[model samples]
Target: MRNTVLDMTRLATMDAEHANRLLHQVRAAILAGRRPPVAPRPVIDASWQRMLRLGFDPDGRTSSELLQPDELEHRRRATVIGEVMRTLSGGLTEIADASLQIMVVTDPQGRVLWREGNAGVMRRANGICLEEGAAWTEDTTGTNAIGTALAARRPVQVHSAEHFVHTLHNWTCAAAPVHDPRDGRLLGIVDVSGPASSFHPATLALVNSVARLAEAELRERHRRTVERLRSVAAPILCRLTGRALAVDPHGWTAAVTGMAPVDRLPLPKTFGAGRVWLPSLGMCTVEPLPGGWLVSPEESGPPEAANRVVLDLSRPRRWTVAVSGAAGSWTQELSPRHAELLYVLAKYPQGRSAAELAADVFGDPTRTVTVRAEMSRVRRYLAGVLAHRPYRFSEEVRVEVLRPSHPSDLLPHSSAPAVVGERQMPGQDVSAERRRS
Candidate 1:
């Protein structure tokens, strides 16, 4: 018989009791370091692996101090998510209440910013401290929808026994992350949670739909804001005779004069009005617009040199690259894949071809197409330091990599073939590991 993936949703819909029992068995077996009768979903399995690696106790109590009243109020007013709360609540509140669940909205850090729904459910939630200001990130609450979705940077559903912590096994949650449509940064999470007995596979789909709707609302609002800014910018750019452009706070182009209209420009880390240097635009003068900035580049020599590169992967959750030289300095956060690729490059200064990189990352040299596409994206920002022929950092630039304290903890979110192999390596550094790879 061909082995196929298990369908937890269908099973739970038909017979929740049987499904719960089976999941308990599977969770117990997996936690005890044994093969389960059936495996959990890939997302859940990955979360469990991370928890295990960190020695998370499945039976331990889970809770954290609530945010102070003043800080909680400030967060509520500070996040962009607050702008879409009404839309999210309108789309999800009724459904959650009808299902005897609660609608929850959390900031990217997984702190509850707002929650509402069934009256009885609200009281029960208080028992678990699932109210405003509670931190629900995986580090504090284990593998559940709000925390796991935040960790994975995507939507997730955690049913009975799928949770790494025993306390959460009695609850079911479906959460989808809301990201800023302008730049793709995580804004927050929208979740529906209730007692395990109330589990409905369809709740996941509902939450995801509402999250997408919230993004649409944000996108439409931004369009109108930019249009208004354009009115203010068009006159300003035409008045002065120079390479001047107006951009939204996020660096989205609104109006331009004397240059090609670029959709967006990457702004420097420390951007402000007055004389400042941008790597792309060179020396520029900036002035505050109502919702954006007006940038005028002084007709000068050239953009600054970016010779030194520092890839910092020392933290478990965050990774960034800082570049600096004769001109100025700036930093950009690297995605998980980018971090892995950069780590590999930093190990072997000799560089790796597309095929070799595919083999190093996927353990399959045939996946060169994917490797090349990713390198193209990396090159977009690092064109100065990256070279193409064989896909390597330029020799003229110095590349420094900051590694995690424990080699095994490197790229905690990465399970690429090369990353996993390196994490399991016995040695201290990658010199001997390079030969093994």
Candidate 2:
């Protein structure tokens, strides 16, 4: 739902009378040589154009007017922000001498939602006014962390020269955009800032990881609410169904009008990994079982089903084959970088050292870290391959091992070559519960 109450309250607070007076004072200060309109002149950029297209409508609303104290109080924005601040602090504190000092969150519309950081960094960022309720659209604030992120919907790193604000030229920031799971909607942004000289490549990853963590929490909040509602409504449907459960998509459930004992209930999969949805009565998942489908409420259930059967075999013409590389050669199915990395790992039983692997592969010492990071990513890719098992690699002796899990061990005798599609990527097909970030 839209934040109607907060929006209405903000509009009332930023009334014309107050705005006119504030503008007059600003003009007077400029005339008296007490302040300048801004430190440097602003210029248009691609980020600005994007924000405008995204409905980041800017008017003359001040901080107080844009965010009402009452709404802030009711929503406990401070408390939530405080928790986010703590999470960020924990995420950054472990890095050795990490210069990251500030972090902030902003709504999808480019309004500052929350901010927290060290005193020194806050003082430095004050000129940009990154406090709660301030606008952070690229056009208004220039190419800063919050603005550029919302504009691009991707993680970005902006150094001193990239900052549009002249006074903010000494700082660098990295930010990532978070999305809502239900429809993959852009929700907010999370950003980290530090001195411009702190340009470690990992800085971007740190910011993205923080944003991902925050986005996870938000998704969990929504999932819990939906789960609770599902819990309450499930049993009621079970009692009425006479059949005890029903499973379908979200739209199917919405079409049913009056309550019936055997009403067709739609069960949109709660967690996307395993293909199943449970609707009504017991909250059990209506999953494909040995012969047909069965509903089970327990988290742990009988295994050996297919990966979501979207096709109905009774209707033969709907048969589809998801193609990748040819059989017995899964390595060939991956991208060039992924294919080479996996091939090397497959041959080395004891794995390899970072230096040894880099020399053999990329032939550059500086590329060692880069290769190691990609190996870390290969582990994530292996998750879908082995029922989400962790892939291990030693940095000291860089050998990738899958530890011979059940799924991985069983893969040798599997019917045919498995084609895990792009959906296997994190956040691609998981249901709302697992869609955190």
Native-to-model Cα distance after best TM-score fit, residue 232 in candidate 2, in Å: 2.8
**Residue lDDT tens for model 2, 1-437:** 12122121232355544533433443334334465332221112334333344444332221223567575444335334334555554675444234646666666666666666666766766655666666776657666666666644567766553454445556667778766543344566777777765545567787788767766776576555545445544545545433333222221221111333232232332332233323122224454322223343434433222221111111101111111111111111122244445434434434556665565456554577777776665443232222211222222222222211112211111111121111123332111111101
What residue runs in model 2 are displaced by over 4 Å at the alpha carbon? 1-45, 48-86, 93-100, 218-227, 241-437
State residue 432's C-alpha deviation in candidate 2, in Å: 34
Clash counts per candidate, in order, are 0, 12
TM-score of each: 0.86, 0.41
> Where is the poorest 10-residue window by lDDT in model 1?
428-437
| Model 2, residue 365: C-alpha shift (Å) | 35
Clashing pairs in 1: none
